[model samples]
Target: MFASSRKSSLFSSLFQTPHIICRGSSRNRVISGSDIAASSKVSAQWTRLGLSEKKPQEQKPAYATSDQRMASLSELKEIFRKADAVCFDVDSTVIKEEGIDELAKFCGVGDAVAEMTRRAMGGSLTFRAALTERLALIRPTREQVQALITEHPPRLTEGIKELVHKLHQRNIQVFLISGGFHSIVEHVATQLDIPLTNIYANRLKFYFNGEYAGFDETQLTAESGGKGKVIGLLKEKYGFRKIVMVGDGATDMEACPPADGFIGFGGNVTRQQVKEKAKWYITDFEELLRELDSDSIKMNHNDIFY
Candidate 1:
């Protein structure tokens, strides 16, 4: 009976697929293409998404040759020019590194977090446990985040500064909408001359002495579909006529119902689904800059009161 039981358990373990594991991260560091291909391929619930453009060569579509380039730049340019408010995703979209992951590396908890990530992926740990445990392991102090910024500033994507500047010049309101921590996103906003008030991201709470307490779970960005909710609030509060969201993720694309358009950016990193769905996809900000007219003035972003 003991031998039979062992054999049965082995068989079950080999065949069972578990769901509690961490298949997706907010930063999207895990889930590779080979893994995706091995997965059912029936639906893309937890696959074909990437933090970088390192997708399976087999999955890459035949290159489009509309001017031998990005097909919908014209449409994107139109939407961009007409937009009242333009929101950007921060981590991989505006900056090259993923903020939370960078914080982990800085806090000397990179290995621990990575192990938790592996466990989360392998179904040995629950997603909730993975997230909280990783946070606990990193417990990034207030000073750490600041020091991370000061010591090793996040790299901005090429042409992003120019893009934001031109949008501001055109009187198009630019806001940083991210699921990343406010501390990191704030730094990026400052570099771009974007106001702190214009940032919609998760906030980290701290003790009066500035020790890490926890992130504010109440923030709209702390939940799933939060970006969309924030865009809804942007419309209600600011009454924007036409808004555009630009980013490199599925969540960013999903925000387009609330937004007038979604522009896919692959300069820093490319995700498969984003490329396939984004009406206008570009790898460089110069593309948008080239499209933006110098004599632009339709809506005045400054006219709106904070």
Candidate 2:
């Protein structure tokens, strides 16, 4: 889907309105001086455009893009490049679909489960509670789950394979942390070559007869604020000097204090709150891939799996 290294319109997208008119292709676009003035005026209201807020007491630069904090963007990328490990949120971040939502759809309780998931993600309902209620609605049997997997395997986000391969070449460890089921993310890990041991996600329980029983509540990912716990554990376990969490949710944002930094991803889905708060918000993996400086590694896209 992301086959083209198309220029990300993140800035241009936010800059457009009834006033400021942009002309030409997204690449060769042009805006009049009046438009620039309009964009600048709008820049003063970054929060309204879902742009990140300036750090308290930090002066906004006149030269900064309407998104603001151009300097902080550079600072975050420096951290990303130095990171010893990077943790990714599995559903929308690593794959194209939300695993639980997909499972719910497969089980034919899509609408009921999806509403709960929306609230869970928005932080109104605790993740643990949402999962409990959603699972109660799904009650998917082992066979059904397997059938869904075989029929509709997890769709990897475009550019992810290349990105993970690049991280590996940098000798940086990669992890998949998700509120999705273990069975689902394990498949994703296998596809990405991330060690199964590095996969942190919820585990489903089933009866001996292969019927759905429930989920293991003991897993940290089974509850709210679980992703941060996982990041904290990773920090303690590895003693890594720098770790970056990249995802598209509030849960992902919550992982950062435990994680050294958090980079928001929006290639598949953009969470507005995530976009507004992330000091370094990106819509495509290419933005990140460019930051890695591939010249040092000397690898080709063809060798990603090898």
Candidate 3:
């Protein structure tokens, strides 16, 4: 059934003129350069960090399959031509490691926490439950959290910096929305020059003595489908006409509706479900840049930041 649906979708895409309906609006419009230029820009409110030197030998994940890769790339080119706002999931999407897993490793519970994380991301376990169990095992300290930050700064996924820079130059609003902790993701946002206010993720709490207390359970991303809720909020509050989400998790797939498009990323980690369900999937960010350039969607440096 899925294969038949995909074939039908590909066939239709070949013949149909591309159009994206702006939700909460009356008219349907073809995606245009001018439309992208008019998208909203929101100020970010997170703390900035100094940029780190790029790793010269960062590892890349293997592609799930060659045939799936080709199809997804072809579809992604069309999607990119229409997107005005792109939200990136931090762990394994924009960054190489899962933040919590790294913390668990630091606390000497690496194997256990990693297995739980696998289950959570694979959709076999509820995210909140896995997180609760893992956190209890690790019980990270304030100093340990800082140590992880210092020793293992979130490594940027290949081509992510360039991708965000290009998107910004095109006057597109780029956001980093993660289920990861703010303490870690903040540094990543700073490195990418993404506004702190635009980042949405779980926040960690600490005692007055700087000991690890607990996470704020109230944040939307603390539970399942939180990514979708955040996407919906972005649409409702900002009035963005076209939004795209790029990630490597089941949660990222869940945001497809409010996002308008979902691009599964496998540069760091490849989940089979994300690869199968995403409208487009890719293992390299450069593929996205290439697609944009091929479609004449490239923006000059001077034309950006309007």
lDDT agreement with native, every candidate: 0.72, 0.78, 0.73
Q: Rank the candidates by TM-score, best first.
A: 2, 3, 1
Best by TM-score: 2
Cα lDDT tens digits for candidate 3, 1-306 = 001111122121122232334557578868887666553211111113344434478553231112322225545555566677899999888988888888888789999887876676566767778777778788877667766776667778779999898788667899888988877777788889998888899877666576666776777889889998888788777777677888998889877666667888999878888888776779999988776665553344546422
lDDT of 1 by residue, 112-200 (tens): 77777667656575434455677778987666766676667778888999999988876889999998877777677777999989988
Residue runs of model 1 more than 4 Å from their true location after superposition: 1-76, 112-133, 294-306
Candidate 3 residue spans exceeding 4 A from truth: 1-76, 119-124, 297-306
Q: How many residue pairs collide in each prediction?
A: 2, 0, 6
| Shift in Å, residue 235, candidate 3 | 0.7
Model 2, 156-178: lDDT tens per residue?
Answer: 88899999999998899999999
Regions of candidate 2 where Cα sits further than 4 Å from its true position: 1-71, 294-306
Q: Which should have the higher lDDT, number 2 or number 3?
A: 2
Question: Which has the greatest lDDT?
Answer: 2
Clashing pairs for predicted structure model 1, backbone only: 22-120, 65-68
